[model samples]
Target: MDRYEGFREFVHGRQQALMRSAYLLTGDASQAEDLLQTVLMRTARHWHRLAGDGNPEAYVRRALINEHVSWRRRLRRRPETPTAHPPDRGRDRGDESLHRLALQEALMRLTPRQRAVLVLRYYEDRSVEETAALLGCSAGTVKSQTSHALGRLRVLAPELADLLNAVDPQEVPR
Candidate 1:
């Protein structure tokens, strides 16, 4: 466990999770693949620095978010030119028929910041404070954004309202 072997094991165990989160953040297969690739490369390079943090998974997740935010910022600045051909198809799209896909699509319709907050708070099961820390925002902002996101989600995907009923209001700090 002292050598690169430990890093290899960590990657093997968490790659799926990393990829899923990346996909959720990006809402595009190609971007998610690229996101995971860059994240892994940076994680490997800074493994020693992060391993000592005792919460490397959180560190890596924060890294993913930072990268996503950075990408969003860059995308905002860059001009998009139309392509002659469409992107390549056939990738691990997961079970597309699952009800989960509906939720994912609805999420993609949200603003990037709202989507990030929703994913961090709900999908990733992070606390408001934790999400705020990761996204570099205040707890109040997280709560308000979460409320707005949930409201939008309810309107965008009414079927998911049942799932919202199952979540105790107290669980998400007001």
Candidate 2:
């Protein structure tokens, strides 16, 4: 098959996983969608150059991380804007949703880079080396960020750490 066809297949196969990672990074569906679209567009533009690379997924993931970091930096440079509408006061769904909401809030409390490291390491199940490559940092940085992020999470929500550690593997062995 041609390089174009191969690149097409590669992108189609990895799109969903990329979107999930983007969602976890941004925490906003619309922003994630836009982020993924931008990444895909940039990837497609360089497909000819990247088609020969064995690790196209890694390249794409790195692009996503760089884009997210750059966007966050730009956002920080802007002045804080007032919201047109008041904060939502919707009723809680249930215990699970409430727990999830608390987790999301805690995630927001982390720095963007810390959140990215945690999501890539734990949520995406990436190794320190992989996350380091994606973030354009060293493996040591990934390890340190993961440790610090988890430490912060533990402080913010000790109950979550307890619940996570309390899972019994033998009860549901695959």
Candidate 3:
């Protein structure tokens, strides 16, 4: 078997999902592309070792989260100020699109860790223990962060408060 065949298969099968996670992490399509590309390159380099591990998806996910957090830290150290105004997005498609945009903007305002927690727990449908494991934090930390993040989101995007409150109570940590 070709040594890289497994890596190729993995990328082919998972790129879209990985890209979605990257987009959620960076909140920009271009940045998400760059982030996914960088992580994929690194994963390719270590594919031999990673393939033997039963959970390459988890490894790649942890890498994505770590790289995103690192990028945020680096960005803080060397922030850029855009002089030009962003191009207008034109009329909202409808109430749903507007709500989605509001939620996304509110997500951008969250700390990277909080955003990561929310993405993993809610978006990815991971359990609190799984999120903690992926994040290298205690389960209690995941629970608290998830609680705090949802609270902050409620504050940041009051318009979505009803939708946020609609999350299944069973899914949220007490």
Candidate 4:
């Protein structure tokens, strides 16, 4: 296959997983698609370097994470105005959808790093060490971020307390 064909195959193989991670990170399907596109474009520019490495996927993931962090930093510096009217609640139906919306809202209250850490560690089911490596931070930072993120979620959505409390105790580690 030509180099372009090879690169296209590599990106296509990893696109679904990348989109899943992006969705969890952004909590918005549209934003996640945009983030994935941005990450893929940036990765394509460095495809030669990445292809030489044993794991091009890891490089792309790191680039996505870095871009997300940078984007959050820029957003933090800007003053955001609240919407005059709340989003339409008509679209939200059933208990499951409400719970998901609550979870998304709680997640939005966290810092970008904390959100990333939680998504990597819990949603992606990565070990703390692995999450730390992906984030280029210490394992302790991952633990702390997870703790803080969970705390924030609990505070922001007390209803979630029941959901967490309902977990089977035997399934959770001490």
lDDT of 4 by residue, 1-174 (tens): 345546788877878999999988888888889988998887777777778787888777777788888878888899678999977656568889889889888888888898898788777888888988998989888877877777677789998888755534443322
Candidate 2: tens digits of C-alpha lDDT, residues 49-82: 7887778888888788789989988988996789
**Backbone clash numbers for all candidates listed:** 0, 0, 0, 0
**Model 1 clashing residue pairs (backbone):** none
How many angstroms is residue 110 displaced in model 1 relative to the true structure, after the best TM-score fit? 1.9
Clashing pairs in 3: none
- Best lDDT among the predictions, by candidate number: 3
Residue-level error in angstroms, candidate 4, position 17 = 1.5
Name the lDDT of candidate 2: 0.80
What's model 1's TM-score?
0.77
Worst 10 residues of 4 by lDDT: 165-174
| TM-score-better candidate, 3 vs 4 | 3
lDDT scores of the candidates, listed in order: 0.82, 0.80, 0.91, 0.80
Least well predicted 10-residue stretch by lDDT in candidate 3: 165-174
Across 127-149, the per-residue lDDT of candidate 1 in tens digits comes to: 88999988888999998888888
Candidate 3 contains a number of clashing pairs equal to 0
